[model samples]
Target: MFELRHVSKRHGAIIALDAIDLSIAAGQTTALIGPSGAGKSSILRMLIGLEWPDAGEVRFDGVPLRRETLLEQRRRIGYVIQEGGLFPHLTGASNAALLARTLGWETSRIEARLRELAELCQLPFAALSRYPAELSGGQRQRVGLIRALMLDPAVLLLDEPLGALDPIVRHDLQTQMRELFALLNKTVVLVTHDVAEAVWLGDTLVLLRAGKILQKGGIDELLDVPADPFVHQFMNAQRRLREDA
Candidate 1:
């Protein structure tokens, strides 16, 4: 559903992504994984039109992503960033309904959608009246997911959505999200630093470092035949984490 072809991005003299190419298919989940400054989030920025590539192209469906079509494209893409990105003043329901209301959806329609999402995410309907500060970390992320899915967008881009939660909570949400993805059948692209988390949520994993893709495949492929010493090291680190878990 999305493609980045030979994409490059730079900030002044520093490169954020260098000739990175990725393709996300419909009804599948792909994870971008790496260490800090690996340009994992840069891919999402370009995909969402938040940042432009210095060279190459980013396409949604079959059309090139440009400023002219960005707004329209974004309406069809659901984005959930770290910590929910909720407005503290707004209640969970308000936050979730923000986009739909802005788009002129009826109040009844919004409430009905919220109800469905509340059940889908296993969040309480009563919690929708609470503010972000009042909700637990996991609850806030659920609120964020509800907000992102409010419009029923065709593509979901999640950037470290479960990064701040406790391990138990993160694990629970991961299971829920796995089921949700299969249920929704939407194209999903997730950016995360945790290899375990990536493996839990993604069908395809892309390992990156120094702003370039090092390897892209299943977890077993990465473990079986690493591209280089760095890939081997990276997979080993995650294996240790898995063992500890």
Candidate 2:
């Protein structure tokens, strides 16, 4: 559903992505995993047209991602960032309905969709009436999920959506998200620093470091046939943490 061809991105002295070629399949969950500054989030931003690559191209569903078609393309993609990325001034309900309202959806339709997604995300309908500061961390994330799914976009792109939550909330949301992904059967691309989370949620894993892809495959493949020594180190680090903890 998404492809990157020799994509390179730079932020002055820092290289965010370095001519990396990758493709994300439709109806599958692909996790972008790595340590800090690995360029995982950079790829996500490019996919959603938030940032452009310094060189090379990003394509979605066979078409190049052009600025002219960006608005249309974005409407077809759902994005959720950490801590819900909510607007402080707007209530949760208003935040979720922003896109649909812009598209001229009826009030009844928007409310109905909000309720449906609130249930799907395991958030209470009443919570939508509250502002971002009024909701808890978990509620904020759920609100974010509701906003992303409000339009029922074809693809869901999440950049550490649960990273800021407590462990219990994060785990519960992860379980719910796994089931939701299976139920929706939509293409999903997740960016995360947690290897275990990536393994638990992602159908395929793409490990990156220093702005380039080090390996792409299942966890077992990474364990048995690592493309680079860094891949094994990265996996083992996660395993060791769990074992030690």
For each candidate, give its TM-score against the true structure.
Answer: 0.96, 0.97
Lowest lDDT 10-residue stretch of candidate 2 = 236-245
Task: Give the per-residue lDDT of model 2 (tens digit) for 1-245.
Answer: 99999999999999999999999999999999999999999999999999999999999999999999999999999999998999999999999999999999999999999989999999999999999999999999999999999889999999999999989989999999999999999999999988888888889999999999999998789877889999888888776433322
Residue-level lDDT of model 1, residues 125-160, one tens digit each, is 999999999999999999999999989999999999
| Number of the top lDDT candidate | 2
Question: Which residues of candidate 1, in runs, are more than 4 Å off?
Answer: 240-245
Per-model CA lDDT versus the true structure: 0.92, 0.93
TM-score of 1: 0.96
